[model samples]
Target chain A: MTERAVCVIGTGLIGGSLMRTAGKAGRTVWGTSDSPDTAEEARADGFDVTTDTDAALRRAAEDDALVVLAVPLPALPGVLRRVDAVAPTCRLTDTVSVKVAVADHVARYAPSARFVGGHPMAGTAESGWAAGQAGLFTGAAWVVAADDGLDLDVWADVAELAWACGARVVPAAADEHDLAVARVSHLPHLLAAVLAAVGAAGEDDLPLALAASSFADGTRVAGTRPELVLAMCEGNRDALLGAVDDALGRLGAMRGALASTGGLAATVNAGYAGRQRWAAARDPEAVRVRRSRLALPALREVGRRGDAVVGWTE
Target chain B: MTERAVCVIGTGLIGGSLMRTAGKAGRTVWGTSDSPDTAEEARADGFDVTTDTDAALRRAAEDDALVVLAVPLPALPGVLRRVDAVAPTCRLTDTVSVKVAVADHVARYAPSARFVGGHPMAGTAESGWAAGQAGLFTGAAWVVAADDGLDLDVWADVAELAWACGARVVPAAADEHDLAVARVSHLPHLLAAVLAAVGAAGEDDLPLALAASSFADGTRVAGTRPELVLAMCEGNRDALLGAVDDALGRLGAMRGALASTGGLAATVNAGYAGRQRWAAARDPEAVRVRRSRLALPALREVGRRGDAVVGWTE
Candidate 1:
């Protein structure tokens, strides 16, 4: 197989990691950052880096190459405009979490480029080039947006990049991507923030100190960057609003059940069943992989060596 | 310190752990389980165990020991009734999560005993004798509730037991304990279960597979025992209902703000600030202690070492 040339614009975590992974996969990789300092940092970290958008775009415009837009949502239009000027013939994709606005903008501004709105549903709270990891997208989902007149080979190349990075590609329309993320991602962040607010409202120091593993787990996403959350919510307002309403409606129904004479048991049973179904829906392999990666080697070894014990009664 | 003779009536996670911790602290500990198999297991595990409720209560009455009702909320009244029949003079306490209904029931049924409602805000998802750990309550919060006439020394003894298990005792009314837990614990579980339902509702397998650390963290509690969750919600119906309403109202307001023409940035900023403030409200030392205990030693060591370099800026 011929190796593809990959150009990643914006040398942040997503961009840098894509360049590194593609390079490791024997692809010719070039990357660009906003500033000279970041560009130098990326180069020092072994990425072929430039500060010039046109140079990066020109590199992507070459034969059998792909361009990745790994910048923030707000920066996408400008980046696409640059790509239009310098790499009009190149196949383009993105790593932005939100897709609706960016998809509309790309359709309007860079009609000539073979644009596929993509979101690798993976990341940490940490950002910047230094936080880049080669296996960051491994076993993650890369959503490829559905659009009209999209080239099959270009889509295949994009999907191949995701596969090479060990991500599972899921085909979706831009609106579906927006809605799914709003339900799973954005709404969780909002709920976490609200939980935090409630937790902080009281003056007692004991309750806060008494907050356990569940509290920590539930509020983890509340620590994410406010600006980014705001951007996603703003950029996909309709979808997020709908998801929020859906969640609240569910919560209201639960509350109503709790208030009724027999409602408490029914609500609790629903919650219990919901949890079981949720756990079943989760990928056991992914969970096992993550647990192995995060746990101490001793624990991992014990788990590996342990004999399986099963009770038939259950 | 006088070695208090304590009789723990239940061999589950809470009871077994309490027995071990109490034994470790040089207290004379005796435990009983409802099942013969559990009693045998507890005995084999080095706990003094019995299956005869009357014999266990007789022992408690003879020794004037503290009686810990560590059974489920639904089982509390029956357990108290049995205890009243055998050890009416003993100072009674419990480790139930929901307090209001249990307290009221005990007040009416076993009013002669100095019944102090207690909740040790600590546990793992695992239950029964094998799952018990000596350090289960370490760095946890123990909430104690009593009527006006309880002896101060008995209260102190209970507090001391909590302290010996490496927990900080927080005094609260039974009603207050119920309400507080409803907000912090019950509501979060409900939210997690509902969120999991939403994620499961999606047809594409990508979302579940692509779910990251954030998703896992948020949904951890949703995978716990549905029976226990249902019991808590059922037992503390009013409080849980109130908490659900509070949470939904806040979430609805946030959704409305995001949906409005005024833009989502301001609302999201407010949430961001709210989360930061919430995190700040926690006692750092307590958090560190708890995290160290739960996480692997290597991760704990990393946290310890990193504390010097990365002071929590937020």
Candidate 2:
């Protein structure tokens, strides 16, 4: 097989960060953005970015390079259709936060191409081309999955992409990925928004001046681009709704037991113990799979629980 | 007024930090703790601490000192009654997390001595004597108030105590302070606990592994001492319930608007705008009065918004 370069579509935060990371790794990288201004800004920031998606796809078709599908959920099916029509030989993966819906769409529409799903669990309240930094994924979880039969070599290439961005590749099933993020990411976004709205709910309520450190940190993600928050919350609506229900049920029980000081204290102490264990067990810096940033992986363990090796299974 | 020594009752996080800071400022200080082990820890950390409450009160009465009532809410009324019986000559201030309820209790129970209320907005998830640091209040707000009339000399001593710990004195009304903290501080605690409980609710629920940067920040305060959270929540139950109801209402609206992309986006955008305005307008570092940290205040402004000056009106 001829050498394939890395091609990234959609120069937003994840795509832009990958482009910069790949460029820094001395790989031939290309990127494209939806907005003309963003495309120009990416170009000015030393990226090979273009506004024309078709032209970029044609180039990738000629090169047979690996394509990174890093667009919003609503735009994914159409983008995959365009890619399948143009670059059938390209093995592709994505940075979509959810995996199941897109994996199903890819399996049906792009049956000729090898594609896996990925989500790098590092993001900030900032968005767009300007907000994307090369170091954004440093010590971040890059969750990857390929439910369909893809060549082991192609999966290795996707893992390489994660390493290029200073990320640790943790492979998991698509359903598992969706369920985990709904509780951890999506639920927190809506909760933050709820708290922010509560602060200003009434003219006489909660003067923002008294919003101390706890309040600021608690609602940090509510300040992210609203369009992105809405897209994400709506994209994983089912899992998010379930998580919300779980949280509401827990809160309802707390309300009932509030008068009993011992009961509330027990829950609070349990949470503290759980958090301490999480901090020790889930250190991102320790999640790497021993493959150096510049080297390819040996693909030893296809499925396991991210224990100093790539955690994935059939 | 005669030279007043600093006497901090309850050598916990706030009180311990104040004692350390006052010691650094070359002031003589005494501390009392409810727990024998905690008193031993404070003394080990170079504090003049004891477990005998009555002896500490007698010392404060003889020294003609400013007593800092830094006990938990459930213990505050009883502590104050002891003060009224034993040390009525001492001018007192408190570091209680909530203000209005304690102020009411003070008026009803200890009308003989002049008393002021205080709350230092700086806190961490960690608690107890070991968690205290001299720099805890270096750039924090020390909120003070007295619903009843206070002697200007005693109020100055209290303000001096705040500056000794490198905090800006921000005087606010007790009712206004409770309302503000109810929305910002208290509601966030319940929400954090609810989310933590939700994390481990169902058998197949969120793995703490997926609790990434956002989730961790959103629930940081949940890991704080449960007893402290219980006292603050129960002490300000009425205000907290109102804030929770407001938050639940906003969340209910979001749940309805989840089907409509534009509607959800608008609420998120409004929250972003509000947070931005808060960051710009509500900078704590810039909220200090022009009086030098070591100088006595001109008492320039007492009844305005908390925009770089004290916001208390007679």
DockQ of each: 0.26, 0.40
Clashing pairs in 1: none
Q: In candidate 2, what are the lDDT values of residues B224-276, reduced to their tens digit? A: 87889888877876676677667766666666666444246656776676566
- The local distance difference test score of model 2 is 0.72
Query: What are the clash counts of all predictions, listed in order?
Result: 0, 4
Q: Which lDDT tens digits does candidate 2 get at residues A27-90?
A: 7899888899998888787789988787788888788778898898878888888888888767
The alpha-carbon root-mean-square deviation between model 2 and the true structure, to one decimal in Å, is 4.9
Error of 1 at A224 (Å): 0.3
In model 2, state the lDDT of residue B139: 66
